[model samples]
Structure formats: structure tokens, C-alpha cells
Target: MAEDHPRLAEAQREHWQSTYGTHPGMYGAEPSDPAVHAAGVFRTAGATQVLELGAGHGRDALYFARRGFTVRATDFSPAGLEQLRAAARRQGVAARITTTEHDVRTPLPLPDASVDAVFAHMLLCMALSTAEIRSAVAEVRRVLRPGGTFVYTVRHTGDAHYGAGVAHGDDIYEHGGFAVHFFPRHLVDLLAEGWRLDEVHAFEEGALPRRLWRVTQTSPGGLGGS
Candidate 1:
């Protein structure tokens, strides 16, 4: 199934680059609702360092930084990362945040048990195969400190766009040059296997009002330990 979309990842990367280039800070400056909620969760967990995947233009990353959490934000699009860096500088949170060009399909460039909390808004549902998504979660597990918290959101099978657009198999569909892998509920449960699954809240975002699930989980290790 993964093989069917050999070029999907690269194509999506290019499309994102172009999109970000054309629409700087496209998502605007306000922090997302999930980010606001994740910030509280991280604070309650005693987290200081935050790792955010798919942090385009640093809206949530800057919010995390301003909230006193050190942030490392990564995205596959260099253009997006550049915009994030610029925004961080303008917000005077550049010292509190770092940007990296990364693809979630690859191993995260961080040591094991490093960050105290991780956040990803709509990152896990990007044009990735099932195996790739599992591997990405495993990488997240590896990089989280003992008992670290992870808050992420993904478009689910119930989303209106789930089956729309150009089908690329693996539940991934490309619409307006953006590819998304709409997740099934079983896949979410599968990814939460070794972790303490906390919550799966259903919500909507954007004018399309994309339906999504906000998942919160904790590492197997006890909270604030190690």
C-alpha cells in the first residue's frame, strides 16, 4: 500500500513549500485551540521543553515560547520553517524557539527521552502510509522523556474530506495539492498501545470545518520521573 504512492511525500513537500511561499503566515498568528489546550496539559505535567512537529509559521510554537516553554519546531518545508524563524525573531522569542527542516517519515533528529512534551497539529495525517505513521509515533516515543506528554491532532475517517479528492491509497487523498492520510479509529488505538491514552476529543477547524480528533497520551514511564 505504501508503495503505491512512491512520490506522494516529495510532491506534498513541494506543494507545501509553494503554498507557504505564496501565503506567508497563512494560518495567522493566533494559537490554535489544541495548542492552547496542550500548553495547559504540558504545564500540568511539569514540562519545560516542547517539541512541535509540523509547526508551520510558528503560531503555536511562539505561543509555547511566550508561555515559558522552550520550543523546537520542525517541518518538512524549509520555506515554512524560515517563516517560523522570522516570526520567532519578530516576537522576541527567537531565543526560546528553534526551527528544523524535517520530514516525519524519517527518524527525528533528537536523542532518546529528551523533550518533556510533544505537540503536532495535523502532522500525523499528512501523506504517510500506515507503517510510516506507526514509525513516526515510535520516533515520538523515543524522543520523549520518561512520562512525557504528547498532544496531537489528526483528521479522522469521519472528516468530510476523508474520501474526497485524488485517492492515493492508504486512506490518503490529495485535495488542492495537499495530501492527507485520514486516520481510522483503530489506527489511533494502535498508536496508543504502549502509552497511557488520556483523551480523544472530536473537534472541527478551518472554514471547511475539518473534523479531527485531538489525542493526548503519556509515555509508559511515570509522570515527571527520570
Candidate 2:
């Protein structure tokens, strides 16, 4: 079965191009507070080789590159990647960053145990279903080396600020102009196949007035255990 909801995918692509593509630097310059704080965690991890899934506009990608990490950023949207490339060029860090067009529902175009760290911000919540989220988690596990860190953040299922007309039921929500689904399980459940959870924290985004959770884990061995 196809892993993406066609309508949601279309909405995402169009929205990103219209808003983010035209202003690639905006994402980095004025990132959400949670995003900015999350990036700091990655920087402090001291990873040398990093992979960023769903790297929209490449803000975090460029941020990591500026910190001296070799970063590979991937997203399903070509327009987003193009903007990221342009951003890299403008920052004079194009040589340090590699941008690839990739879908998280499929196997990542990377070798097993290839990267030292991985980050995904605001990517899991857009999956539209738990199965797609699991697929994405599987791929994240597939690409990281043992002890590699996986850091990610997502909308919390407990938020009460959902738009008017929003209905929520078991990890799924139908809301104004769109639908969103969240993995209701605690952070341990999202750990990649052989990874061990290191820390799990939750914070509320003041602007969105929404709750967000962040998790960090370390791969146990060379492969994702079943």
C-alpha cells in the first residue's frame, strides 16, 4: 500500500512551496523556539556525520553545516530541496551539505551504519497514520550506526488547542482545513528497532500554543533489531 495520503501530501507540498520555498532563510532565521532549542541539542551532541530527514528549507541542515558537521539533508519535495540548495550556496556552505530528494516511507538512500546522528523535526506528525510513522522510524533506524543518536520532535496528542471542529480519536484528528494524526505512545515506543532511549522531554510551543515532545536515543548495535 502507498504510505502517504495523497491529499495531505499535496497540501504539504503546495503549502511549503508557497510559504517556505520563496523564503528559504526564514526557516532558520526565525525558527520556532522548540526547533531552535532542538538544534542546540544536536550541536552539543558533537556528531561529525549527520542526516536530517524531512529537511524542509534546510535550515537545520545549514545550521549543522555551519557548526562543522558534514550534513546530508533529504525531503520528498523537490522545490524544498532546491531552496535548501540555494540557501546552502548563499551561506557558502554548499560544499559541506548534500541535499537529496527522498520519501521517508521508503528505504533511505544511505548505507547501513553510515551516519553519526539523525534529526527529524515536525516530520512524524504529518504521516497521517501510525503505519507510515512506523515505516519512517524503521528507515531512521536503518541508516544510523551503533550508538548514533536519533533526535526528533512531534506534536503532542494531548494538545487542547486544536482548531475549531477538530475531532480526535486514538492517534488521529480531523480538524479545520486538514487532518493530523499523532503517535499516542510515550517516547519509548518510537525508538528505532535496536535503539535505547536516552531522554524524553515535552515542551509547549508558545506560538502554536501546542504541546511538543522530543526524544533522543542511541542505536544499540550495527543494525535495527526486530
Candidate 3:
């Protein structure tokens, strides 16, 4: 059905841009629960640099910087990235953070094995197709060093909104002008094919209490061994 609507990703990008423009810093200044957990994981893994995808408004990015990790945060929305940059400046962590306006459907801008850890909050469940999501994971694998950790959250099929909204096929549905691809368990297992899956923890967020799975995986090979 996504083939029937080829502009879905482009349209979703526009919607996110407009949404962030209308509601600047909508998610507030606090880092998400996943981000807080990820910081501990990264520190244990001896990670000094972090790459965050879909870093809206830089809440988590700023947190990583505050934790003493050099961070590069990327998002598709320029408006959101601008807000993130402003926050980073105000927080006096601008030197430790960098912002990029990027879409996950494209390859990551970094070179192979560049980052020690990667974090993505609710990014894999965006308006992207299953194939695109897989490709994004591959890119993450490419950019991470050996034994690097990748933590990401995705709204799963268990979510209340899974079947609600206009169907776009591939489990993608549009509701309240937001498009989401609710992931199935099989997809998550498939994405972790090559990597060592560390954990899959269920959690809820927002007033609607959106259901999500926080997945942690490590790249192939032991730390610095690959």
C-alpha cells in the first residue's frame, strides 16, 4: 500500500517539520528514560562518543554531552535541530555536541566504525518501510566500532494505535497527522540477526502511554576486536 502512496515519507517529513515549528521544544528539557538507561550502558561499555539518530530537540543529545560523551545528533527536521543547538548552547555543552539535519532513510554521514555507541529513541518506528528500517540498522552496524552498543526504541504491534488510523501497509498507520510503523516481534529479531541482542524491555511513554520496546544490541566481535 505504501507503493500506492510514494510520497508518504516526504509527507511525514513535512508534517514533523511543521509540528516542531508549531510546538518548539515540545518534549521538554528532560532526557527520556531510555536515554538515561543508555548512558549507564555506554559508560559500562567504555564508550566515549555517541551517535544519536532522530534526536528531536536534543534532550537526549544534551544528556549524553552532560555525561561527558562527545555526541553527534541527527534528525530530519531542521527546526528541531535548531532548537537542539540552542539548548546545547544555553546548557554550555555546545562544544561537546553537533547537530545534523538528516533522514534515516539515507546512509549515515559518518565513516565505518566511527562511533563507540549509538542511541535512537523511537526512530525505527517512524514512517519508514520495513526494508528501509533494516537498511538503517545496517548503516548503524557499519558506523559502529567493534563491540559498540546500539540502543533503540520502537512502538510495537502491541500499541493501542497499531490498527487505528489510515492503513499505509507494512504496518504503517497515520493518525493525528503522525505516521508510525508499528514493529512486529519478528522484525526485531530479524534486525538483530548479525548483532548480539542484549535485551528487549517493554515500556510506556506520554499521556497516551505509547507502548514501546527498548532493544539493546552489540555489534559483532568483542570490544575493539573486530
Candidate 4:
């Protein structure tokens, strides 16, 4: 289990850093559809600021910034963050975007109820354990303002590689030198505890048609902080 092995965790980080450093455009240059839809939803909700987790290469972060939202883009991989920073500068949205080195396993570096929206694309499934996912959700909730929006996507357990790789822990699998923690349907409930479950949709993307769940939830404004 990676949770039981410090070296395993470090290796996982190195793998991602290397992946980003080598390929650079691992996910491509275009912003994802879910991100665009989420930005519209946030706009509908009167949001002006967004906190994006695992903002690799800043496609979605730059998208949000270009759409007039102040975005805090975070990723644990320094190479990825640097790439995002460079993209933001080149896109002329550097003033609207802040790139940060952050790991979702730890507490967030923002204040409570500070952001109007939280967007995370396939980040929850990136080698995170169930406990870590719960902690990350808690942090997201804490950093969101009242009635804030939360939009995220994760690989569904029904994906083609669900059981193809070596088992790490729980639903986590190591395949092709990458670790992915596929999410079962029940995992959605873990994030819906203190928020309103607004949308849960089946989404597939990329050439492999990677199966995913696009979840959108909203934090209650008052008398709702459990």
C-alpha cells in the first residue's frame, strides 16, 4: 500500500513530475468540455473566483481566467505548475491566474470560505486513497464560500483498465507505470455529505473514451456546515 510506504508515495510523485516534464502536453492543449460547462455553471451562480485542483498545464485554468474569473491553479508537480505559469503568462492571463505547488493530500493553503468555486478534473483519481479523497473533499468544502460550487471529474470503476493493473490498495491500480484510483458510484456520496448534489453525469473523453463521472455540487449558504 502506498499509504504504508513512503518511497512508493515519493516514486508516484516522481513519476508524475517526469511524465509532465517529458511529455509536457500529456493531456493536450485544449480545455476539456466539463471545464467549460463548469465555468458556465459557476457564472450562472454569480461566481468570480475559482480554485482549480491538479491544474496540469493550465488548459482549464487559463480558460477560466480568459472567461474573467480569478483562478488559483494548483498541482503537486512542479514541472506541471511551471508549465501552467508559462501558459498563463503567454496567454496574457497571468494577472488573473496564480500557480501554486500543492498536494491534495495535505490541507489547502487558502482561507476558509474564500473561493467561489472549486474545479478539479480527474484529480481525485490520481493515486489517492479513499481517506485522502475524503480529506481533499473536506478541504474543498472548507475553502468554498457559502453556496459555492464544486465541480470535479474522476475515472469510473467501469473503465476498461479497472482491473487490468497490479492492485495497490482499494480500487487503486498500477498500470503502464501510472497509478489510478478508480471511483465507484458510492464515492459520490462521500462528497455530497454537506453539499447539494446538483448533477452527476456519465462523461467519456479522449481517444480511449476514458469513462468518467462529472459531479457538480453546491455548498449551502446558511445553517449547513456539517
Candidate 5:
């Protein structure tokens, strides 16, 4: 599926492998704060299993496993998924964490209504077009059980690097060997259907204060929607 789209296919392999190879434990050992908070929220909601898109290096996946949630950790990079598998084994949580090489632009492999929650950290903003994002969100919605939660983080349109790179399409820009599709708040509301938006908040991190939109939503109680 990635091969059909030049940008998506191009962003999937070599560059990311090089980036992961440049440093062992690239994203570090700690889980992102949003992942930590989501775990608590999931626990309160009685959710025990999750499907995480772009689960690079297993940091957040491992964190969720430690919190007793079985997580299906996926990424487009084989290197990233391999790293996650090794980390899961080392942490003795391999049974709780499953790793797969997956591209969010395509349909998810899980069965319908199979997971309690769907998660993605910066995955939605990684070179995916608006149409692709809508398909991805719908796939996430499909795999989640009724009323399941969906949480994803994206680079905000206000980010310092938003327009600093070569323009690709829409809000997409390529810089430093990576392409990111920044999202305005309105775009989320526009593309996101079938699910109710619960929150869309601003949060920044890193030295550059990388602006982010942390969004959370819930599928409708019946057939589920995102």
C-alpha cells in the first residue's frame, strides 16, 4: 500500500532506519507523558488492551504493558519494530506486547472491535495526507470496541518548523530528512467523523518547544465511530 504513494513509501524505510541507527534507544527509555496519562484514563474506563500505531522503540508500548494493558505495537520501520521486540523481551513483557511492521495509510490487520483503545503519538502527522489520515482514523475506529478511546498527537500548524522546510502538499513539509504534515485544529474536526472529539489541547516539548495537538476521542456506543 505504501508503494502506491511515493511520499508514503519514501518516508517508510531508509530514512527512518538511518535515524534509528544513528543512536541506540533513540527516543530514550521514558514513556511520553501523554502515554502515561492515557494509561490512567484507560484504567478508569476498564480498558485493558490497546493498539498503538507507530510504536517506535517500544518506550510507550512497554509503559502500557507495565501498566497491565496488552498492546499491539506497530510501526512502518522493520528496524523500529525489531527494536521494540528486543525491548519487550528484555523487559519480560514480550507476552503483553506484540510487534508488527505496519503502515497506517492502509487498513489495520486487527479484527473489527478487537481492542479497547487505539493510540498514536506523532504517527498521524508523519507525511500522511488528509485523505490518508481520514482512512487511518477510520481503521482505528474499526478495530476499537464500542465506546473505545482513540488518542493521537500531531504537530500543530503553529510549530516553529511548520513552514521552514520544502513544501510538499497541503501543510506537509520536508526538513532534516523527514516529512511532517502539520495539522490545524480545524482540519481535525473536518477529517474526523464518526467519533466525538473530547479534547484538543496544546502541549510543547523538546528544546525547540515542538508545538503539538494532543487529541482524544471516543467512539459511539453502538457500532463505534472515529
Candidate 6:
């Protein structure tokens, strides 16, 4: 199993607490309105039991719950989970959510084929290595039933905003005092690991032209075949 990088995890905890936890609206360029889109998609698909990996501040969790889904939101950072719990209380949907502390680098504390849907936003990029990212995806698949959906978004490679002129050799990028390891894969590559790709929507964030790709997945046939 991949162990969490202590330094990177600690830095991420502090960064998220000071940024997204304190004022979630300012954490990213997008507003809460986009969550309406996500919620609508989930509702249309009739997803009731949801699991959110790397669920920061429970923004998506609260949105899904408000739309009548039971959500289990998990993150490695306690500080982030605290914010999520508080947000749930403030939204009057605390009863609909179950928050847990989880390290995505290892196996998740969930029964096999138990979850109906899994959501992840801006999580795959946070991983420091491709192996780690694949490990997390495997765990996501493990917790989800066959044909269950995985809704997620990720940063694409070599976008003019974040990756232009930035040399990312085998998944390492350094810029603006922040060193990030990015694993950019084609949609087919994601499907190679037993996930059936449903969609891939690509868009740029603001004027910076930073790209985001929304992808959806369904569980495969066997452990290594899908």
C-alpha cells in the first residue's frame, strides 16, 4: 500500500484549512452554482448512496444530501472534515451525512460493492504519483457496486494557464512556489483500469485558460477487466 507523504499531507492540511475551510467560496474560481449541475446529474441518474473521496468542506456532499441522497464524505485531513461537519450543520443536513477521516493512499474503510456512487473533485491531481492515483481509483472501484458510477474532475495536461512552459517530466510540475506532481492521462487510460468512461467534458477556468475535465465512470466486469 502507498503511504501518505508526511510533508505533503501536512502542507495540504494547513493550506486547505487556511483557504477552502475558512472561506470556501474563494478557494476556486467557480461558484456554488456549478454544484447545481452536479446535483442535477446525480438526481437524474437516481444515485442515493454516495461516497465522496477527498471531500473537502463537504460542498458536494451537502449539495447531494439536500437533493435527497445519503452521503458519506471522507478526507485525510481532520481540519477539512471539521469544516464539512460544520457546513452540514449550518445547512441543516447534518443528519444526512456521515463524515470519516480517510487517507486515500491506502485501502478505504468500506465494504465491497456497497456504494452506489463515488464523487471526487480536484483529487486526482493532488496525488504525488501515478501509482498512488491508480491505487485510490482501485479503492474507489472496490467500494462501489458493479455498474456504480464515479463522478470526478481533473486538471488536464499542458494547459496554457497552469502547464504552459512548465516541464512536467513523468508527473512533476513546479511553478509559483508550489511544486505539484500531475498525472495527466487520456480518457481511455482511465478506462483501462476497469472503469467504463461515460463522459469527458473539458473547459477552461476563467481567463487563465486553466483546463478542467469532468469524467464519469462505471465499474467493470472483473478485477482487471472492464
For this target, which candidate reaches the highest TM-score against the unseen true structure? 3
Give the Å shift of residue 172 in candidate 4: 0.3
lDDT tens digits by residue: candidate 1, 123-159: 9999889998999999999999989999999999999
The lDDT, on a scale of 0 to 1, for candidate 6 is 0.69
Q: Give the per-residue Cα lDDT of candidate 3 at 97.
A: 97
**Cα RMSD for candidate 2?**
3.8
lDDT of each: 0.93, 0.70, 0.94, 0.89, 0.84, 0.69
Candidate with the larger TM-score of 1 and 6: 1
TM-scores, in order shown? 0.97, 0.81, 0.98, 0.95, 0.93, 0.80
- lDDT by residue for model 2 over 154-196, one digit each (tens)? 7766776443344444355655544555546553474444678
Model 5 over residues 207-226: C-alpha lDDT tens digits? 99899988888888833334
lDDT: the better of candidates 2 and 5: 5
Clashes of 1: 0
Best by lDDT: 3
- Ten contiguous residues with the weakest lDDT in model 3: 1-10
Q: Rank the candidates by TM-score, best first.
A: 3, 1, 4, 5, 2, 6
TM-score of 6: 0.80
> Where in model 4 is the C-alpha error above 4 Å?
2-5, 222-226
Candidate 5, RMSD to the unseen true structure: 2.8
lDDT per residue (tens digit) for residues 1-226 in model 3: 7565459888988999999999999999999999999999999999999999999888999999999999999999999999999999999999999988888999999999999999999999998888899999999999999999999999999999999989999999999999899999999999999999999999999888799999999998766785
Instruction: Pull out the clashing pairs in model 2.
Output: none
Per-residue lDDT of candidate 4, residues 14-125 (tens digit): 9999999999867777889999999899999999999999998889999999999999999999999898888888889999999889989899999998889999999999
Q: Model 6, range 126-178, lDDT digits (tens) per residue? A: 63466667778888888887777787776767555355334444454545534
- State which candidate, 2 or 3, has the greater TM-score: 3
Off by over 4 Å in 5: 1-8, 222-226
Off by over 4 Å in 1: 223-226
For model 5, what is the error of residue 54's alpha carbon versus the real structure, in angstroms, after optimal superposition? Answer: 0.2
Q: What is the lDDT of residue 200 in candidate 1?
A: 97
